[model samples]
Target: MNIFDRSKHIYLSPDFEEIIKDTIRFFNGTPVHSISIAERFHGTGVYAIYSIAKTGIYSKFHLVNRTAFHIPIYIGKAVPKGWRQARQGLSENTRSYELNNRIREHSRSINLGEGLDIGDFFCRFMILEGKEGDLIGTVEAALIRKYQPIWNTLIDGFGNHDPGKGRYEQAKSDWDVCHPGRSWADKCQGVPANQEVLLQSIENFMAGLNSEEDA
Candidate 1:
């Protein structure tokens, strides 16, 4: 059964999220609990909300959470069926997480020496010393263009996520499946109109940054 068909709804997109790969592993630095939660629990019950299962037979069943990370990462949620179909709809050139170890590997940037913050999580996280955004954005826009129609159908079907109130109850089939690849947008599907949504996602993520400025 589709996981979203149940009472669970992800507060944040788990389809594609940037996490300190080390956070989920015994990287000889991070904590065991953090890695355990990331692996066993699937993700921090916090920002990058996800659905998890203990075993294969009863898989679809997952617990919803929001505060599951000590690192800041962005979650990419494509149209609804995005996770359902996997990379089958993408181009043959479409990157596959299953093909390489990097796809499922861990990442680390800043050590959350303190704990976790929601607004902090929303803030923009760039890489390659700022160049990461350019490379990432370009790729995202391309995919959005190729999958325009299907993308529209999925986002529309997933429905709207309230700015902060919690579950967007209206989504059709929410799941915490891993993203097919990093930067799924690869430039917002190449649609000029779609850029706005991508921007909104950025805006939503940087909510904490906004508050800091206000302070």
Candidate 2:
């Protein structure tokens, strides 16, 4: 019997791994800017949002990212519109400024949050184009896997949009419960998450990060 089974496994070449590493390095080297400033740029790519808010449950998060933004509270990607439908080709409107628009939307969300201040948020983004644009989702997945950001992993719905008419049957997102100001989220008829439980989750997550660093 053959010891190695090549038929059942997929191989990942070292070069392929290097490409992902290089892409991550490029993204990390991009300048960090305030969310307002970041929303002015035009391109489709991935971004990381860091919080420096010292409010109640977020103070620990602020301390970790205050000096250098090594930790991101949220990581997300913005792809060109219709890219999903086209799958293989670029959209006809390549200059749609999807990345900028997405960041602008986030700014609006933060502004609406009762406890979140727009001034405490910052972001870093890489505007990938041409062949590199195809790697946008890949890069975003890699970052989220590496950091396991609070918004991306633990607490969800930071990236959600209002489900239009008659679609409010689902439970309200943990994020909506904690932040509590997006008008449409109020209409969600299902059970809402306990804010205390979400805060405890955030506390535990921060503790785990501390343990990892101490190790």
Candidate 3:
């Protein structure tokens, strides 16, 4: 199973749901399957957490408190600093050590409940662009944080790995309908999407969420 499958009761605010749907629909030909959103959190207007996942590729995305959708947006060419350092030819063991310590420190700073559970996939394989397109590279898990130098160029906004397709690009407009600027996901950036389409968006996310319940 993928990381999204491992999570329970993920939530997504209504606008986030639209971005997730648009990203998936755009990338379906690439054949990505994601985790579903589970429970609704206490937020005004529309907000939720979702168990989104897509697995068996170079990249895997699992998230908690992540407003943006993962996997699809992250896979292509998004290397954090430590991995880049390794590519320049650092020892693998050294790379892993630095990464883990960084994450532990960050995780420690936050309460157990609040942290970037971006997932083992991110921790392990750094996101990269392969011959086919964006795929995960088998880097160690801990190196993704990149310290203050901040290596990743991939967007932290809405979707992680959409390949910049027009269909996916349309999500930019849609996302704006609900959350405006500064409401970004962790390390997040999302194109605009139409929040007015709330009903249909919720239905799509619910399909994933309900599937989790069935499983």
Candidate 4:
């Protein structure tokens, strides 16, 4: 069954986290299709990344292929940087336009890496119209906490930016350790986790999820 279909059970409690789950559930109803990085997305919102089972180490995830889109591997939020400031009449800026840029950055990183194909990834996003503070952040945190995507947890740095000079001396991120393609990451001095460890981590995470579902 489609995961979206499974999400029809509405939460009776009015917790803020339920809003995040509900938003994701709404997008899960959209048709699953791959999008080009060149495509532009606007507004403040949350997004989810999907992958085919045949793609790179994601094959190990063994995401059940019952839906048009595979299981969500990552979830994120984007908020217009100046939305709050604009309200205070401090600045006129409205759109951060960083949402698509962030996704494209991920695509570029994936394309440059060995054994990973940017083409295997697809995404679904929903725009949240109103917010000044960390509303998007709350939703993002909720989704990540519920899903526990490996990119968000075990292999961090999917949201990383260039640390600039002097900082390159810092150890590489677990993301770089596993995927290894970002040019800046190469300069960072760090020992990456071996493939065996990486795979084991993924396996354990999946097993835990399965155990929870069974219980």
**What would the per-residue lDDT of candidate 2 be over residues 92-130, giving only the tens digit for each residue?**
565567899888889899899877889999999998877
Ordered from best to worst lDDT, the candidate numbers read 2, 4, 3, 1
TM-score, every prediction: 0.19, 0.88, 0.25, 0.74
Q: How many residue pairs clash in each candidate?
A: 25, 0, 44, 0
lDDT of 1: 0.25
Error of 2 at 160 (Å): 0.1
Q: Please provide, for model 3 over 97-187, each residue's C-alpha lDDT reduced to its tens digit, 9 standing for 90 to 100.
A: 3323333322232122121333321221111222311122322121232111111222222322233433342333332233333222222
lDDT per residue for candidate 1 within 1-215, as digits (tens), equals: 65554446536755434332222232213322232123322111111211122332112122111223222222222221133443233454544232111112222211221122212222111121122222333333332343232213222312122223333333222111112122222222221234345435433433322121233
Candidate 2 pairs with clashing backbones: none
lDDT of 2 at 159: 96
Which 10 residues in a row give candidate 4 its minimum summed lDDT? 206-215
Ranking by TM-score: 2, 4, 3, 1
Best by TM-score: 2
What is the model-wide C-alpha lDDT for candidate 2?
0.84
- After superposition, candidate 2 runs with Cα above 4 Å error: 1-9, 87-94, 211-215
